[model samples]
Target: MNQDSKNKERHQGRSFTNETLFLKDLVGFQRIKYRYVNVLGMLAGLLIVVQAWALSNLFAGLVSFNTLSFFMLILGLLAWLLRSVLHLIRDLIASEASRNIRFNLRKKLLSELTFLGPKRSVIDEDAALSTRVYEQVDALDDYYSRYKPQTFMVTVVPFIILLTVLPISLITFFIFLLTAPLVIFFMVLVGHKAANANRKQFSVLAMLSNQFMDMNQGLSELRRLSRVKDARERLSSSAKAYQSTSMGVLRLAFLSTATLELFASLSIAMVALYLGLGLLEKLPWQLGSSPVTLTNAFFLLLLAPEFYLPLRQLGQDYHAKQKAEAAASGILQILEASTSDSSTTQVHLKDSETPQTLMLFDSLSLDANKRTRLVSISGHIHEGERIWLSGESGVGKSSLLYILLGFEDSYRGQCLIDGIDIKQADLSQWRSRLAWIPQSPEWINGTIRQNLTLGLSNLDSASIHDALEKSKANIFIKKLPNGLDTKLSELGTGLSGGQMQRLSIARALLSNADVWLLDEPCASLDQETAEAVLETINRVSEQKTLLVVSHDTHPIEWVDKHWKLTKEGLYEVA
Candidate 1:
């Protein structure tokens, strides 16, 4: 894309101020890690000047064949060793702090996503969340552990060096003062532009990730439709876009580094030229007495590079700061979202006590896109009621299911369990009284027993066997070599539609919950499998309050109440 187009895409309502605040909140002011790192860095800075002084004096003594040359050389080496050890220890401490910070930040982000739930959160794209949680948060590692501490040294270390040099040569000190601010001014200017570029780069990365995830998820569909080439082209386009954006960011980072290097080199050269001229007593103009000794000249030259070292380090980590800030933008959006009402009363329901009345009074819900799905809806189901709710695909059947699951609260009215608004009841307590079997049941790469029990420690083998038998899964499961111990692939890859459906039913039965919410239990199954699943539902409904959503209108023996949802409203049907 052209610069203008890229800039427009990047400026899509992003507030740099808000992003800055997000980063500040993430790092915070009272960081104990920062404090420790700063103290060690300042001590290291002090030792740096000491080592420089020793080395300069050693050089002068050696030139004069002085006896103290060896002692000065030893002192320099010792100071150098101590400085190296301190830096190593400081880095270790900073690394540990970075690890802890990343861990805590990821945990906090995940908690926010959980509180937002799938309904409120953007969950369709797996890569979006992964990029924010992993890559974006990781970018902060250098900023916290390296860049930030170096930033402090950039300010304090140079001043300390200036103090040491002032008594030896005021001219060298004045030259240092004049050139240092120019490097900073250029670095700050370049760094500001680099931050914007980095933000754009991270945004592109997220887009690329989402695109790749979509391509992966829909590859089968694309191949079946003979549109794989189209999909590939789209993915390639996204990849190219990301590459271009990344190159732009890298170019800016390189430019900033080069700028800092150029200014630092020039500045050091200027100081060196002045010191050399003064030592030779060859300056065209004189401001003060030339107190330039070989030792003083060497000391000033040695400290010049040290003065610019932190600024160079800061420039190197400048991009890291920008990337972290960009990542913080996404993280903070989730963190700052208004949480759902967590108000809950002491009212609790027994696991096996089938709800006497589950009612929705004037309840409504809007989908994630903020489109009205259900409007002024009202309904009731009594204990032991077998209800089948049907609707056209977009008529809000799933929205209602989400509401009853306590996953969506974009609705306006009330949902009550036994006359108490479920909103007022402890959601965890209320959810425990129910079991849900989605159209696509999830399974881990484990044995059938693990999938069925789902880590419920209290569920014994006898109970599992009984549940499986009731769901008709026991017959097929027993034939396997290890029966319940038979391992399956992710999503139960070896199982047929009928087997997976039966497994879901078995899991629900094992819960022994008062109510069962089955969403399209017979979907995508062959006629025989569908009949078997319907039969399992028929058997389960007799003992529990069953709410099923199915497109198949063919009457079933188990259904005691029937309802249809529409854009107008929800109502009972014949």
Candidate 2:
């Protein structure tokens, strides 16, 4: 079988104890907050018992034509009010705890993605990560706010009611004792199936989310290829599959609830039958007399359903537990995988120290998907030198830039900066001294000013205008109605390809990094615009290092040296 199937089988086979342990570990300090919620639940349970007792006594007094005790009436009302207040407080605490936990988990997930950088895409699809961060994390809400505390309530509340019932009548107590296990039995029996269905539902949801995201992202391409129909059919199939799994989960949930209700109703009926016969003084056995008094019989009858209430609620929350387990599997997969990988050391470069030489030795190679991309390559580039790197498509030119950016760590041999292996240095600190411009620059839906100054601060207006003019983007900015304040849609919509590229160059110029890695920087520009941008780049980077990767030969004219990458290795074309 394939790896995904194997993983699914393993996840399904995981024991309940193991799944609970995983969820508890995620709860972290939030577990302490649950302790307080549980205490409130216990208090609520006691109040429920008190309220039931007082009401039973008052009702028996009325039936017997005795004067009602105003004190018992007052006591019952107070208990009910206090119980409601406790429930409100408990819910508030649990909701806050759930919110905080989700927030912290999302934060950790984001940090992991940031640390993984470009390599994160290799591990999982963006759509899958997005689903985990938003929907799957949300699935834990019911688990924390309801199911977790109900677990304790199911044990404590029922036991308290049983204590109240046992002293009143042994027959009622035995009935409670015998029938309670049946409800729990069927709950567990149906719960196993529900858990499996929930996991399948989560799996289908992630698949559906990924498929939809892919279709949305590539909708333009699909239209161009006249394959939109095919894409739609596939998406429809995934949606249908998701619907099937979701219905299966709901059916099981209803089945579990019905099973619990059937058992609980029968148990309550059995208690009522015993209490009615005893109250009528119609004992079936040769016992001296009916031990059940009117007050006692009424109290036992009142408390019977309350005894099973926690168990019934627990049966309902069992589904939430299943959902949380499924969601936690996805969440823990990302968290645990990040921890298992070998991480870069925390060695930081001195602020006063700048890399003067970059060296590669000992047959540096990069392999991806079991195919060699870079083979036995050795090279060096000194500071303040503009090198033009030329290679055909699929020759690992972009991969080399990825390695220097600390985004690819699977490369063999050493990439050193001024005698320090780049792998050993803190990547954030290392990347701070370098700027990268990819073929297609990324932008958010915001004003042009925000896009330009992203992750930067304390820039004066003069500096911003200077970078804009140097990159020749100021010419277009002047024509726009809002200038730099112009709001662009996602991916810099409303801007031409050349305009977007110029903005990227202008942003890089503002960074003032010592090393600049440009991949097809002028690919989107016309010949005239390309030369203007390249000229600005050459002038600005004269004192810094430049490693420009291009398929075209035009950029070679102004470079200090030229490097060609072939299947064998990288070679200097002097």
Candidate 3:
């Protein structure tokens, strides 16, 4: 690649990372803040202070063990009840935050998918996109919200308590201070390696997930061919891989935890042993009237366990934290993927009768690694200039459709609108002016009108009914009990191939696009039906530019022109 190309790629890669990973980092910090402060925080602070004081006095044996000491200890223990209540509240808050953050992040990721929908054809397939959206995105999101904040809290509050405890007693302070760092270091050495493996597994699982979803989406076709079971087995293997890698990470987490616990226990014992010797040597160094005694030793020992509690929990928290970071890194890689332009640009559609054509594509060609579609394609379409594209299957007709829509940018040649580079033209504006009808219209399970509208609004019933009737889509639609409002399955189970094609066209017509790109609009229809649909296209293209890609079938019996696909490129057919 040239220096300019490499620089552009780098710039885009950086932007994508910034946009995608910021969500997790932002959510993680905010979650910690919300849980750590407020009324609950104040109570935890108060409990720690009183607990510290009680243990100190108990070791001094200033109060009698009979009733006074027991009474004070009981009061301090009860005040510590706030810790339990705080835990419960933290869990409740953490649960909600996790769910919300996950939901929002997933939603954002899905929206970005839509934004990049056109450019996706440059990749091998949309299957990867689907997995990124439905599966991997969710897994990574779960880690972000659930265990992430816990990790932060474990890292934060424990360190704070360590500092607070150090001023009180050097022996107790050294025990936790020395051990916590070891836990983190040990976890990094072992768990970090596992995290790398988990990350690799996630990538393969993502690939397998996309393939499986693709296979499932095509299940009907696979079912006829008896390949459904094969697909299932394939997906099962991917699932197994994901499970084993995840298990490996979890196992490392457990081991790291065990090692941390062992070290903490040993440290506390050493502290206790040191204190026990100090008490035995109490008479050697008497301070005025009182010498340190067994009571004081017992009291310090009692305080020792609780001191280690905060620091020891770090081991467990480290595991959750490492896993979350691993998941976040995966998502971050995708989000940070560099694209040509990440900024939003606006370019509106041009009206047919408008003096200056708003958008134009002169000798446009799209080249991609997808499905061996178009090669060195070049064409021009103006408002009122209807065209048909004929090509062999797997020659990238659909890929070409995506290129015209400004999705794939890997192709050569410039696309101009009104003599301006479409590359710099606002994409959102350009897309707003387009209406597309795929060979198989997506039949989401919804009311007939919803299917017809595709949830895109603002079409009066007259325009909608007219488009449906002309496209031959209204026949089955009107037969339904609710007419346009009839409910349909996800793939329009009750509707035939022809009905699906027409409804999808109606949805596109509703978009009121200035340019229409159709791929095999009449592929599954009979001679008469295909002719009728062509007639509809002819009518629609009168005030709009229409680009059609198909094999033998040509829509618009009187299309303005037809372009035949050649091995080298596109050429106008006489």
Largest lDDT belongs to which candidate? 2
Candidate 3 lDDT, tens digit per residue, 1-574? Answer: 4334433433432433432355445474455545553345446645665666676665455544533577666766776776678767766666666666667666755555555565544342566666555565555544444455445555555555566666555656777677767756775676666667666766777677677767867889989999889988988888888788778777777787787778778877887776766755643454333333555555456655655565566556655555555556655554544344534244443433654544455555554444345666655666656778887776667777776676666556676766656666656667778888877765567788776666466777898888887667777766787887777876676677666776767777778777788888888888887776677667656767778888875445577788878667777888
Full-model lDDT, candidate 2: 0.82
Q: What order do you get sorting by lDDT, best first?
A: 2, 1, 3
Error of 1 at 81 (Å): 1.0
User: How many clashing pairs does model 2 include?
Assistant: 0
**Order of candidate numbers by TM-score, starting with the best:** 1, 2, 3
Worst 10 residues of 2 by lDDT: 6-15
Compose the digit string of candidate 2's lDDT tens values, residues 12-99.
3233346678777667778888989999999999998899889988998898977898989999999999999999999999998999
Whichever of 1 and 2 has more lDDT, that candidate is 2
Model 1 lDDT, full chain set: 0.77
Task: List all candidate RMSDs to the true structure.
Answer: 7.0, 6.1, 5.7
lDDT by residue for model 1 (457-504), tens: 698778988898888998898789898899986557567888999988
